[model samples]
Target: MATLRRYDLDWLRVIAILAVYLHHVGMPFNGDDFHIMNTDSSKLLDDMMVFFEQFRLPLLFLISGTGTIFAFSKRTWIQFTKERAVRLLVPLFFGVLIIVPPQTYFEHINEYASYFEVYKNADFGINHLWFIENLFWISLAVIPLILFLKSSKSNRLLCFFEQITAKKFGVFFGVLPLILILISSKKYFPSDSKDILNLSSTFYYGFFFVMGILFASAEGTWIHLKQFRKLNAVLFIISTIVFYAYYFMPSEWISPYLTINQRWNLWYIVCCLVGWTFVTTLLGYAQIWFNKKSVLVQKLNEAIYPFYILHQTVLIVLAYYIIQFELNIPLKMLLLLVTSFPIIILIYRFLVYPFKITRVLFGMKKRV
Candidate 1:
């Protein structure tokens, strides 16, 4: 059978990576302690980043999960595992060793004698490549489940989801498992930590990964998503508002009735809702608008993985210098954005695109 091509997913992947680039560009000014920080920070940018945080990584993971189905459809489990190891691990190792050290060097320049010193230490962890690392492991972890779902045994499981998605509001039920997973385990695991060892964060993202598989497994799910796009949009808006309102709400203003733990769990539940609604809303709308193919989309889809790998290190290096200039936050951000984007693309086009070795190191399929 010929593999199905999802133009909408291709479009979403490109858009998500671009959003990630923009988010990183805003990081220095967003009042967060990133690898580098600006002298002055913006509360507005901070608030915007906070809002985006609820759903950004979740969307990527879900899309990755969906992509996994397509990937696995073309290969046996062993082949799929090897492909993932090559596609994910090789780049992760390259990023940690080659690409990520510059960010660390710039971050703590005074502490290190030279970039080579930082590289020699090899203590720079995965940095932004954490996503790639998590994805590789999650891909391996889900193989058994994916295989089961592919077998005759999972027919009833797929059928159950199909029936639910057939209802007007049934697609929304997908969020319930995620909410429960988060609310119950968040206290122990603290979903905010990016450490792969952090069970809360793993489960939180893993649920989305699993959901992506289910969405791909159940053919009717996309129809429900598109059908309820409007409703999901409204809910996304409402949930975002509620999430922010709760975020900005003073602790002193809270009712004495709600315990601190209860309040925390409530916040987790709200976050799950916002994340689910945001993802479903975008998926639904993308189905309608981005399902058609484009030459640009195809190009972007090919470059996006390398772009993501290169973006943060480049952004951090540029921002380290850009932040020193006597410019306002917006101008600095604009300068960094304008300069780094093309530089990343050029590096990919000239350095990473043509060569088989560079292509493999950066997680692209080695061209013949």
Candidate 2:
């Protein structure tokens, strides 16, 4: 039942890291999703994108929150804050100013935007590194509350949340308003770095990270998820399909209400609930099925952080070439994915493993 047990975290990290890699590079054979659409069946890949999209950020939030509970419990507030800032904030700053700008510069230079313009533009820094910024910002924003809350009775907040989530009806009603809010402000809700001005993501989605830290205190929950293995497996598959079906239908056709209203508030909540539950539950089951002691899980868990930071840059490089060559979307995607794996491994071997950048960038330790 140990939450941070090597295997469980390893499995989740592998799932997250690979899912993210796929998100950027896309499925190996998916070509229609390229900037230039074609008559290929790669529409299915786009469908897959919608289905898997819900869980990537959310699962990451849960994993981080779960780890934070363990981490914060062992350290003083100052220690925890310093650790988080060092790990996330420092990297975010560097990513914006140094590590990320070259690629940003390269990608947008042809678009007639000035360097000054790019610097001034809020979204210009580290296009895909938004997660690191948000993670740091959310952690910093929530620490005071976390310190205050954690100082009180250990189980008081948890019991309160348990009381809320314990009820089937409460889950529906509690998430319904957030859904409405997201739908109302769909253009805003953490869609990009610019959305920081929109308070909903800060208050709603950011709060989920807080809940992740709080609720994940119970590594025992994995056991509960495991207990429901057979049932959850069926539900996960069905929900994944339902999630994809939404993407296949044009938004105009499926929900004129959403398009006219221009909000993801309703569907976001509904999908998030189903998505969060199934993804974590399935991961828990995977922890069991993959037997946690496997070598592959261990290596992947170690590589994921660097993989995350480095993959997008690699993906963009490949994306440009694929488009330039006018290759079939599926074939190009396949070639790009094949090319990316060796490049990612090589980068990790040099910049991270030998250079030992984890201490400076990702707040992680060596294991692989």
Candidate 3:
């Protein structure tokens, strides 16, 4: 049977999604081309943004993969797929149709065009809900492998992962494939564009998803994580500090030791390292610290999906007018940040959760 509720994983999911929210809120002030823009931008903010960019989504995907193992253990293939579709797809479709348009509309509303005209154009796209769209498709694509791994013949392959991860050095092998795939992806597919409906970043995230399945199937995986928590934490910090050196250090200071391409290759490898270490470390430490259930986590865990779907739209729409207030960047960013959480919470509590039709459409379970 699948194990009892894992609150550590719940904690990880909540933290990762909140990081995503903060990232989106900060993106505008960093001078990036986002749905909204600030009048003045900061290189400091830009550097901070790049730092979080390294592991934020990768960590999220890894956690999803870990959770998938437990989720699959309890359900047959038919039930699993049905639940996945309802939980992931329903929100993506609903958000795309109802929630996403406002963000795009705000983007173009000040650009000499009507909201209807902007909404009519396909160029507006799905906005932040791309993660949901991509994940749903990936879940569908991996069904055959998920089934095969559950069979008898694949016992050896499953045993191999379990044995390797159980060893002191086995974690190295677990992380090696991820490092290689990340390096190869950067070297070959240098395009940094995102088209959510396409398999643009599939090879990248698929590796993590598969790793998650393997990790969860292995007995005592959480035990291994806890055993090596300190080591992973040290490596995570050192790698991150060095990763920042590449940006903060003067180019002339390090150019003699490494060329630009060499520097970037090294940086990309560290990105994978930091991402890997962070996920493992968080898994380890969270299990140690956050395994208990509580009302706060319970409420946040239940609300996380809808919060993610609604947060960006709320922020963007609010920001559309907040930017025009002649406030400083920090104040503007702060106002949007403070206003967003309460509004999203209130909406979910009253507008989305209470209605059965809205709940199902928003990817919540229907009321009894």
- Candidate 1 per-residue lDDT over residues 1-368, each given as its tens digit: 11678899999888888888899999999888899999999999998888888888899999999999999997999999999999999999888888988898999999988778885786577888989989999999999999998899989998888888878768777889998888877878764778789988998999999999998888878888999999989988988889988999988887687888889888888888899999999999999999996888888898999999999999999999999999999999999999999999999999999999999999998564
Q: For residues 1-368, write the lDDT of model 2, one tens digit per residue.
A: 22345466557757776887887777433553333223444667766676676777667766666666666766887898888888777767766775565556556657646656556775445566777767777776767766765664656765666565544333333345546555556555545233455665555556457656655654444454556566556666765665656545576674755554443443565576665556546655775766547777766776777778777767766665565565777677778889978898887877776655644665456444
lDDT, residue 181, model 2: 55
Model with the higher TM-score, candidate 1 or 2? 1
Q: Candidate 1: lDDT over CA atoms?
A: 0.89
| Predicted structure 1, TM vs. truth | 0.97
lDDT of each: 0.89, 0.62, 0.79
Candidate 3 structure quality by residue, lDDT tens digits, 95-201: 87788888878887766377676556654467788788777777777778778877887688877766776777567455677767766766666666655433326
- As for candidate 1, its clashing pairs are none
Q: How many clashing pairs per prediction, in order?
A: 0, 7, 0
Q: Tell me model 3's lDDT, rounded to 2 decimals.
A: 0.79
Stretches of candidate 3 exceeding 4 Å from the true structure: 122-124, 196-200, 253-261
Clashes of 1: 0
Error of 2 at 236 (Å): 3.8
